[model samples]
Target chain A: MRTLAQVVSWLALAGTLAPSLFYLAGGTTLAAVKTWMLVCTVVWFVTVPFWMDRAEKD
Target chain B: MAEAPPSSAAEPVNEYEREPVPEKARLGFKSFIGQYAGEHTAGTELMIGPLFVASGVAAFDLLAGLLVGNLLAVLSWTLLTAPIATRARLTLYFQLEKICGRKLVTLYNLANGVMFCFLAGSMVTVSATAVGVWFHFPMPGLNDFFPNSIGWVIAVLAVGVMVAIVAAYGYNIVARIANYAAPWMTIVFIAFGLVGLREFLNATQTTLNSGADLWRLCETAIWKGGTPLPGQVKFTFWHVTFFAWFCNMAMHIGMSDLSVFRYARKSWYGVATASGMFLGHYVAWVAASILYALQLLRTPGNTDVLPGPLADGAAGVAGLICVIVAGWTTANPTIYRAGLAFQAVFPRSSRYKVTLVTGLIVAVFGMFPAVAMKLLDFVALYGLILMPMGAVIFVDFFLFPKLGLTSFYAERTGGSFNVAAAIAWFATLGIATWLVQAGYTQIYFVSLPGWFIAAGLYVIVSKLHQRLAP
Candidate 1:
C-alpha cells in the first residue's frame, strides 16, 4: 500500500507538472490551457490526500 | 490560547525543533485553509495588484497568467514543500541545521529573519497610509523615498508598536485576528471590484448589457496593456505568469513554509493553499487592480499607487478600516515568523524577547517609504535571494539518497558545514545574478533554471565531497 501510494504521489506530481509546463511553453490556446490547468489541479489535489492517507496509515 | 509545552531538562518546553510534530499537536486541513487564506489576502495584494497595472499587463495575460501561475504555486506547496514538512516535521531552520549544519543554518536564519523584518515593515507602511488619511498627513508619493510628514512617521510608529506587541504575544493572536479579518476583507475586496465596475460603467457610460459588452469594457477601460508608465517594467504574459508563480518563491519553492506545514496532520493538506492563492492572490489582486485602473481612467496624470486613498474612494470609511486591518493581519504573522527565525539563532532566548526585537527592526525599516513603494521589485528580489537554499533542501532531501550519497550528510558526518550545499547555493545565485546583469533574462525567469542548477550542483558536489571524505 505504501509503495502504491508513493507511485500515485509521483504520478500526481507529474500530472500537475505537465499542464504547467505546457502553459509556460504556450502549448495551447488560453481557454484550452486554462481548462487543462483546472482539471490537473483538481486531479492532483484529490489524489494527494488519498495517497497521503494510504502511505501514513500505521 | 495554546499553552506552552511542558519543559524538562532533557526535553525542554520549547517548540521541539529536533523531533517530529507529535500526533496530538498536529492540526487539520481547515486550520491550514484559514491561515493561508488570511495571510495571502492581505496588504501585499493591494500593493501587488497595482504593480501589474503600473507595469502594463493586459486583461487576458494578467487574469490567465494568475490562474495558471497560482495553480503551479499551489502544486509546489503540495508536492515539494508539504511532503518535506510532513515527513520531517521540523522548522526550516532545524531541518537545514541537520542537513547543512549549525553554522550554515545560522547564516540562513539571519537572512530569513532580516527579510521578514523588511516585509513586515512594508505592511506597517501600508496600515500607516490609512492612518495618514485620518490625520490629513502629507503621505509619500510614488517616488518619495523618505517620510514626507511628521504625521506619517508618528502614524507608522504607532502602527508598528501595536503590531510588534501583538506579534510578541505569538501567532495565536495573529491567526485569530486574520481569521476574523479574512472574511470581512474578502467581502470588501469583492466590493472594491463591484463598486469600481459600477463607477467605470457610469463614467464610460457603458452598460454591461451582455458578456461581450463586459469583455469589451474590460479591454478598453480595464487592463488595456500598453506602454508601462515611465520607470516601470513592461509586463508580458510570461512576465505576469512567472511573477505570480515566483512571487512567494521563498515560502513555496524556497521551503520557508516547511515550518507552517509541519503542523499539518497530512502532507496533502497543502491543497489548502488554494484558498490563499485564489482568494488572496487572484480575487484581492484583481479587486485592488480594478481600484488602480479606475484611478488611471479618472486621472491619468496621477500614476501614484496609493492604497489608502484608493480604498477610501471605493468604500469610504469601511475601505480605510479594511486597509488598516489587512496590513495588520499580514504584518502580525510575518513579524511572528521573523521572531521565530531570530529565536532559532538565539535558542536560549524566549520567543517574546526575540519577537519584540524583530518588531522593532521592522518598525525602523517601516520608516523608509522606498521599501513599500518599490515592493514589487523588492518581493521579486527577496524571493530570488532565498530560493537557492530551497533548492538545496529539495536536492538534499530527495535526490541525495538516489545518487548513492547519504542524505543529511552534515548530521551523519558531524561536519560543521557541508561544502556541497554551500557551493550549490552560492554558485546558483552567482549564475542567476550574472544572467540578470548580462540581460539574458529577468529575475522571474532565472529562478526556474536556477533551481535546476542548484539541484544538479548539489548532486555532483556531494559525490565529490563524499568520495574525498576520510
Candidate 2:
C-alpha cells in the first residue's frame, strides 16, 4: 500500500508538471493532458489516505 | 442579566502550544504537495491573473519572471523554513513567544490574525462574484470599494458561513477539502485557458499555425506591454518576478509555514511547495490572464475585472463553480490559520469559536469590495507587515549562536517582550514604509532590503540588550 501510494504521488506530480510545462513550452491545446490529469488526480486522492494511515503504523 | 466572560475564557482543543509534534503524527511529503497546490491555485488567481493583464505585463516578462521568482520561493521554503520547523515542531506563535516573549508574541498574533481575516475576506469576495453571476446581482467594478447590492452581501454571507463551518472543524477537514478540490480546480483552470485561447483566436481570425504566430498574438492581444490601466502601476519582468517571489514571503521566509511543515517527516518535504508555485501561480495565473485579455478584446471599453463574469463568460456554469470552490478551499485554510493566530493569543479559547468569530470578521471585511479589487497591493502589504518578524526568527535561529548571542533570548531571560525583537520588527517596517511613501523605492522592492535591515537590527540590538541586562 505504501509503495503504491508513493507511485501515485509521483504520477500525481508528473500529471501536474506535464501540462504546466506543455503550456509554458507553447502547447496551445490541452486536449491530451486533461484526461491524463483527471485520472492522476482521482487516483492520488484515493491512495493518499492509505499512505497517511501507513505512516501511522511506521 | 449575566455578566459576559472575558475573550480569553474559553478552552481549546489541539492547542499544542508548548510542545513539539509527536513522532506518530508526522505527515508524509505528499500531504504538503496537495495542501500547497490547493491553497495557492485558488480564487485569488482569477482576480490576480486579470490584474497582471491590466498592469500591462508582456509575455516574456510574466513567464520568465514567475519561473525565477517561484524557484526562489521554493528554495526559501526548503532551505530556510522547513529545516527549523521540522527541528522545533512548534507553531509560529509558540516559536515567536520563545524568541520575542509572550507579551510581544500576543501583539504579533493580533496583527497576524487581523491581517489573515482581511485576506480571507478577499476570498469570500471572490466566491461572492460567482454567486452574483448566478443571481444576476449587481457586482462591484474594478475600482469600486463597497458592496453595490443586497444580493451581493447575502451571497458573501452564505459562502462565509459554509467556509467558517468547515474551518472550525479543524485542519483535517481543511486538508480534505483541498485535496479533493485541487485536482478539479487545476482542470477547470486549464479549461478556462483553452476556452479563452480558442475564443481569442476565433475573434481575431488568428491562426495558431506556428509558435511565432502564437507569440505574436500573446504580445498583441493578451499582455500588451504599455501604460497600465488607470490607478495601477506598470509591471515589467522585474516587477513580476519580485512580486511572485515575495507575495508569500510571510509563509516561506517569514516562517509561518512552521505550523504546516512541522507535521512533515522530512524537511525536504518543503519541495512540495513546487506543486502550488507551478500549477496555481503559473498556469492558473496565465489562464486567468487569457480570460481577461479576451474580455478586453470583445469589449474594448468594458474594464470591469470581476472574476465571476470573466470566468462564467469563459466556461459558463463550470467556471462559476470553480470560482466558489477555489475561494472556499483557499479561504477555509486561511480562516483556520487566522483562528489559530487569535487562539494563540487567547490560549484558553475554543478554536472553533475563535474560527467562527474570525470567519464573521472576515465576512464583514468581505462586504467592502475594495479588499478584493486591490488584492495585489493588499497581498504585498500583508507580506511586508509580517515579514520582519520572519527575518528576526531567521537570524535568531541561524545567525545568533554564530555571533555568540543566545537564541530564544526571551525564553532564556524569562522576559515578556524582547526589546531587540520589537525594535527589529518596528524599525524594519518604519524604514520600509518610509521608503515606499517617500518615493525611494516601490513596495515590491522594499521587502528584500527590509529583510536585511531587520536581520542587522536584530543582531546588533540583541547583542546590546543582552549585555545591558540586569
Candidate 3:
C-alpha cells in the first residue's frame, strides 16, 4: 500500500510538470496546462498524505 | 496512588536547547538540503523576483550577480556559520546568552521576533493577493501604502486569521503540509517561468532558434535595462550581487541558522544550503522576474506588483494555489518562531495566545502593501539590524581567547547583561544607520562595513570593560 501511494505521488509530481513542458514546447495550450495541473494537485493532496509523513511516525 | 514522577530520562528533550546535541541525534547532510530548499523557495521569492524587474536589472547583471552572490552566501554558511555551529553544537539563542548574557539575549529575541512578524506579514500580503484573484478585490499597488478597498481588507483578514489559527493550534499539521507542498510548490514556480516565457514568445511572435536569439529575447523583451519604476532603486550588477548575498545575511552572517545547523553531523553540510540558494533564490527569482516582465509587456502602464495576479496570469488556478501555499508554508513557521521569541520575553505567557496575536499583527502589516512592495529594502534593513550580534558571537568565539580575554564573558561573570556586547550592537547600528541616512552607502552595501565595525567595536569595548571592571 505504501509503495502504491509513493508511486502515485511520484506520478502526480510528474503530472504537474508535464503540461508545462508541453506548453513550452508549443503543442499544448496554457489552458490545458492549467487544467492538467489542477487535476494533478488534487491527486497529489489525496494520495500524498498517506505516505509523506509516515517516515516521522516510524 | 500518586504515580511516581515520570522518569526525567523518559521525558522527550526540548530539542537540546540548553546543551550540545548528542551524537546519536545528529542529522545527515540530506536533511539540511531538503530544509534549505523548502525554506528558501517561498512566497517572498515571488515578491523579490518582481521587485528585481521593477528595479530595472539587466539580464546579465541579474544572472551573473545571483550566481556570484549566492556562491558567497553558501560559502558564508560553510565557513563562518557551520564551523561554529558544529563546534559548539548550540542554538543561536543559547550561544548569544553565553556571550551577551540573558538580558541582552532577551533584547535580541525581541528584535528578532519583531522582524519575523514583519516578514511573515509580507507573506500574508502575498497570500492575500491570491485571495484577491478569486474575490475580484482591489489589491495594493507598488506605491500604495494603505489598504485600498473593503474587499482587500476582508481578504487579508480572512487569510491572516486562518494562518494564525493554524499556527496557534495545528502547527504540526501545517508543518507536515509544508513538507508535502515544498516539492510541488517548487515545480509550480518553475512552471510559472516557463509559461510566462512561452506567453512572451507568442506575444512577440519571436522564434528562438539559437542562443543568440534567446539572449536577444531576454535582453530586449525580458530584462530590458532602463530607468527603474517610480519609487524603486535602480539595480546595477553590484546592486543585484549585494542584494542576493546580503538578503539572508541575518541567517548566515547574523548566525541565526546556528540553531538549524547545530544538528548537523558535519560542518561541511552547510554546503547543502546551495540547494536552496540556487533553486529558490536563483531560479525562482529569475522565473518571477520573467512573469513580471510579461505583465509589463502586456500593459505598459500597469505597475502593480501583485503576486496573485502575476501567478494567475501565468499558470492560472495552479499559480494562485502556489502563491497561497508558498506564503502559508513560510508564514506558518515564521509566525511560530516569532511567537516562541515573544514567549521567551514574557516567560509566563501562553504560547498559543502569543502566536495568535503575532499572526494577527502580521496580518495587519499585510493590510498595508508597503512592506511587500518594498521587500528588497525591508529585507536589507532586517539583515542589517540583526547582523551585528553575529559579529559579536564570531569574535567572542574565535578572537577573545587570542586577545587574552575570556570568552563567554557574561557566562563567566554570571551577569544578566554584557555592556561591551550591548555597545557593539547599538553603536554599530547607529553608525550604519547614519551612513545610509547621510547617503554615504546604500542599505544593500552598508552591512559589509557594518560587520567589520561591529567586530572592531566588540573587541575594543570588551578590552576596556574587562580592564575597568576587573
Candidate 4:
C-alpha cells in the first residue's frame, strides 16, 4: 500500500513536470507545452482523487 | 451560592495553544492545481526575466539550472511538507502557536504579515508601471527606490485598491481571477518572445533563421552572460538554481503553504505546481529576458528597468495589460495569506479587516520606487528574514524527538515563550549577518545554509533550555 502511494505520488509528480518536459527537445514548441499541460492536468485530476483519504489512511 | 470553587481558582492552565485548522472548506484537487500554478506563475516574471539578462548567466546555466532547481523545489515540497501537513492538518499559524506561544506568535505574525505586505506591494508596483505606460506617466529608474512623483503615488494606490478589494472578497474570487488571467497572461508572454525576435531580425538585417540562429539569438541578444551589472552580482547556473528553488522557500520547505495545501484532496496534488514552474518560471522568464535583451540592444546606454516600456516595445497594448494584471493576480493571494497570518496572531479580530489594513500598509510602501526597482536585493533580504522561522518549524516537525526533547515543548511545559525557538531564530540571523559583514558571501547566498543553521540551532538550544529550566 505504501509503495502504491509512492507510485501515485511519483505519477502526480510526473504530471507537474510535464509542462517543463514538454519544453525539451522532441516537442520544443509552446503549443506542445499547452498540450502536455492539459493532458497532464486531466490525468492527474483523475488519478489523484483516488489516493486522497477521507481522513488519514496509510 | 456566589462563591467560586477553591480548586478551580487555585490552578492556572497553560498547554500550547493548538488551533487545529478546521477542514471546513473542502476544495477539490483541481483548485490546488490552479492555485499553485497561478501563484508560482506570478506577475514578477516581467522583472525576474530581465534581471536574469542583467545578471549575465550562461545559456547552459539559465536553461538547465532552472530545470534542476525547480525540480528540487517541487520534490522538497512533496517529500517534506506534504507528508507532515497531511498527518497534522494544521496551518503553520496553528503549529507555530504551540512553539512560539501567544505573545511571540504576535511578533512572528507582524514580521510575517509585514514581509508579505512588502512583497505584495512590490507586485502592485510592478503592475502600476504598466498602467503608467498606458497613462504616459513618469516612471522610476534603476537608481530611484523612492516614489518620484505624485503620478507614481496615485498609480500605485489605484492598482493596490483594486487588488486588495478583490482579495478581501474571498479565496474564490482570487481563484477566479487567477483562472481567467493565467492563460491570457501566458499567451502575451509567448508573444513577447516571438515579436521581439522579429524586431531583432529587423534591426540586425539578417536572413538565416534556424534552430542554431534561435539559440544564438538567445545567447547574444538575451542572456549575454557577462560581468555583473554595476551593483549586481553575476548569476550562474548555481545562482539561478538556488534562487529559483528558494524564492518561495518559506512557502514550501518552510511550510507556509500548509494552510493553502491543507485543502488539497491529496498531498500528491503538489504535482500541479509544474504549470507555474514551467509556464511562468521557465518559459515566461526567458521570454521576458528576451524582451529585456532587445531593450538593452536598442538603448545600450540606458540602465532603467521599465517593464511597461519593454513590453510596449514587444507586443504593444497586450504586454501592458499582461503586466498590470500579472501583478494583481500574484498580489491577490499574497495579501490574503498575509491577512490570515495576522488573524492567527490576533485570534479574535476579523481577518478581512486586518488584511485590508495590511493592504493599505503595502500600498503606502508601494508608493516607494526603490523596493520594486532593486528587486533582486529585496528578494534576497525577504528570504533571509523569513528563513530562520522556517528553519525552526522544520526542526520542530522532524528533529525534536531525535534530540531527546519533546516536540512542541512550549505546549508541554506551559511556557508561553520557548527560549530555544527564540535562540535559533536570532542566532541564525546573527550568524548570517556576521557572514555578510565578514565579507564571506553575498546576501542571496545566505538563505539555504541559513535555513539549516536555524534548524540545527533550535534543536540544540531547545534541548539545553529544557534541561536548564528546573
Model number with the top DockQ: 3
Error of 3 at B277 (Å): 0.7
Report chain B TM per candidate.
0.94, 0.94, 0.97, 0.90
Which residue segments of model 2 deviate by more than 4 Å? A1-58, B1-16, B169-174
Q: Can you rank all candidates by DockQ, best first? A: 3, 2, 4, 1
- Interface RMSD, candidate 1? 14.0
User: Candidate 1: which stretches are off by over 4 Å?
Assistant: A1-58, B1-14, B348-350
Which residue pairs overlap in candidate 2's backbone?
A: B10-B348
For B1-470, candidate 4 gives per-residue lDDT tens digits of 00000001101111112444346644566665555555555667777877777787878789988898778777877776776666666677677777877677777777778777878888888888888886787888777868878888899999888777777776555555455455456655766666566667656665545788878766775677888567667998988888777776666777766665555566787666666677667777777777777787888867677778887666555556667767776777677767867886777888788778777777887888777766766776776877787777778877777767778777777777877888888888899999988989878788878888988888888777878888
Task: Give DockQ: model 1.
Answer: 0.02
Top candidate, metric lDDT? 3
Query: Which 10 successive residues of model 2 chain A have the least lDDT summed?
Result: A28-37
**Which has the better TM-score: candidate 2, or candidate 4?**
2
TM-score, candidate number 3 = 0.97
Candidates, ranked, lDDT: 3, 2, 1, 4
At residue B182, give the lDDT of candidate 4: 52
Model 3 bad stretches (over 4 Å)? B1-13
Q: Given candidate 4, what's the lDDT at residue B387?
A: 73
How far does residue B257 in candidate 3 sit from its true spot (Å)? 0.5
Higher-ranked by DockQ: 1 or 2 = 2
Tell how far residue A32 is off in model 4, in angstroms. Answer: 24
Structure candidate 4, residue pairs in collision: B16-B411, B145-B369, B145-B370
